[model samples]
Target chain A: MKNRYDIVVVGAGPGGSMAAKVAAMGGLDVLLVEKRQEIGSPIRCAEGVSKKGLKKFLPQIKKEWISCEVEGARIYSPDGTMVEMAEEMAGSEVGYVLERKIFDRDLATLSGDAGADVYAKTNVTDLVLKDGVVKGVKGKHLGRSFEVECNLVIGADGTESKIGRMGGIDTTLKPIDIESGVEYIMTDIEVNDLCNFYLGNDIAPGGYAWMFPKGDNMANIGLAVLGKYLIKKNVKRPIDYLNKFVKEHYKDGKIVSVVFGGIPVSRPIKTISNGIMLVGDAARFTDPITGGGILKAMESGIMAGETAIDAIEAEDFSENELKKYEDKWRPTIGMKNERNYLIKEFFINLSDEKLNDLARSINEVKIKEMSVTGLIAMLIEKNPKTLENLSEILLKYL
Target chain B: MIYVDRYKCGYCGTCVAVCPEAAIDLLETFIDINDNMCKACDICVKICPIGALVDEE
Candidate 1:
């Protein structure tokens, strides 16, 4: 293998693979490295995405990648009352549950087919810096020390991003900014063709528990709790909450798989510097409201790849040139992420009574005709005095 | 044996995710490591973000 390339993308998740694919297709020598032996083993996500979001990036998605088609979602309040809304009514366009293991590998394969060198089991230990500019990476590949020289490095390494830190970016998150998540893939329990979200402080404590059906008798059930709330409540882990949920809701289900990880609900940090850029979870691009990141990751990865090509061709790999990526994405998803963070803060502090009241209002209204903003508006209007703070946050979006 | 520093554990469950033996369990108050199932591979030690898991001699 060549010891040098024009670009090196760390991590083989959706963001890294998409970046590598786009750069290689643009006729650049790109190397995509993954720490794990397999590209998609030990999946860390809930494996859910919207059809429209998937189509925006990979227009020709294969049927094998889709695990199930969801027509709508059912949200349950703390008091056991449920509000069902169609995919169109939700306005987020989430209509599919994905088999992420298959999807992740397919993306890596596409990157390879597009002329990028793909290396697995390559753990990047440190960045190769010169004059405080990232020049490449040094790591171990298959138990042997290896070095790869590159003009630019893209850090797509999820929530616990080492590359982002090695490049002199502080990727630390306060307890409140991080969501500690745990999930289980279970079978042998019948489920409807809709995703389910259970909201209440008693149920999740500053987060929400979800069940995404993969098939007739299989589902990915999980919950993410605010780290701050966990400490305040003396809860040691999210697994206990997940275990309790499963016992109460699906006692007959059989556990098939387990996944645990952290999701960053904070706003995206200043992620770009000379010769280094952060995408995906490394950049904290996950949606604060839904904790969904697949779409945003792919979007940012494509933008980073295209930006890298432009920087390479221009022969200006300075920090100013790389700012183009931030300039382009910030106005789009970055702003949305900031808005969602505020909304998350507001919702996380709501009491069970307020949540129940919100649910009752939704149930009484015509939810099928309401957009996300409209729903928020209705909540704000009904409890004008109680939801006054939320109204301020929703003003721009509304 | 795997020693867990209960105070430091954030309970993100990275140890459980990487454990080949599934020896670690996050209970309501702390992480429980099944000694019978634990192979002492030390993957948990390396993966812990907070240095909560340690290999006891």
Candidate 2:
């Protein structure tokens, strides 16, 4: 890595790598650093993505990156009512279960091929600022301290984004806006070619339990809840919920890999400060209701990459110069995130009785399309009185 | 002070996100909870998957 570069992208998840790749592809000097020794090991995500989303951002699907291609989804309400939807109608998260390790590494390689210097095991401990503007980063590489000066810093680091916070971007995540998640990659389990969701307050509190199939007999069983749900509510932790679900459902499955992390279910940060840009989970780009982020991360990474190029050309790294990014992403990613956050707020606040009523109403008939908005629209028509209090919020998304 | 059990800690960084005080961080090998910055709210302790964080009361 160079002592100085045009841009320093921190964290090698999808967001950082894509930013580096797009910037380097624009002929800017770029350095991508990942804190881990290996690119995408000790996996943390649920590893599911949309085939349509993949085709939109990713160049082409590599055989090695896929775990399975599920046909659709089955959502269970608190009353055990199931609503089945086809993969095309199952919304953005239902098509492919990725081996994220392979997918993330491949994206980083794409960045390297585009001429960005990529280094793993380099931890960015601090940012170097001059006159209140970020100029570089200080960290350790291979057990030795290292520093690199850059005109811009892309904080693609995940949910707990210290870079964003240090760079004067408010990365504050409220307990209610954060979802603590844990997943177990299981083998020799019973599952079909469908992604399954079980929703209930008693089972998952402020979130849901999911089984995203990795194969016919393998799946990732996971649970996530807002921190408030777990904060002194008789439940000690999130794992307790997952353990109980496993005992009741997939008790015979063998655990292969375990991963845990937090997802920001809040709106995107209000601003991107001078010389600093937050992408992916760092920017709270994960979908609020579904907690899915790969596609959003890639989209924001591309936007950040494009912004970096413009900043270098104009030689202006001011927040004004970066406003074009907000201009481009806000309408797309930002507005979508805002809509979803509102929807998330509405859903999580619903009592089990309301959820079951809504789910039963949804199950009573076959909706032609089964997206989040479609489901809520169906509820509006079916249980107008029950959801009347929340219809004002969900209506805009429709 | 909140004591994080390093052995059971999954280093998932969940604690770091939910920490309104921004006291917890995922260090190189383990999670580091800065006592001086901690407010002892136990929000991190409640959210941790393994219950690795403890309010040392």
> Which model scores highest in DockQ?
2
RMSD of 2: 2.1
Candidates in order, TM-scores: namely 0.87, 0.96
Per-residue lDDT over A93-198 for candidate 2, one digit per residue giving the tens place of the 0 to 100 score: 4479999999899999999999999999999998899998888999999989999999799999987788888888878787888889888999998888777899
* lDDT, each prediction: 0.82, 0.86
* DockQ of candidate 2 (2 decimals): 0.76
lDDT of 1: 0.82
Sum up the clashes in candidate 1.
Answer: 0
Model 1 RMSD to the real structure? Answer: 6.3
| lDDT (Cα, tens digit) per residue for candidate 1, span A126-155 | 889999887788988888998888889999
| Interface RMSD (Å), every candidate | 10.5, 1.3
DockQ of 1: 0.09
Q: Which stretches of candidate 1 lie over 4 Å from their true place?
A: A87-94, A369-374, B1-57
Give the CAPRI class of candidate 1. incorrect
Q: Which whole-number lDDT from 0 to 100 does residue A312 have in model 2?
A: 99
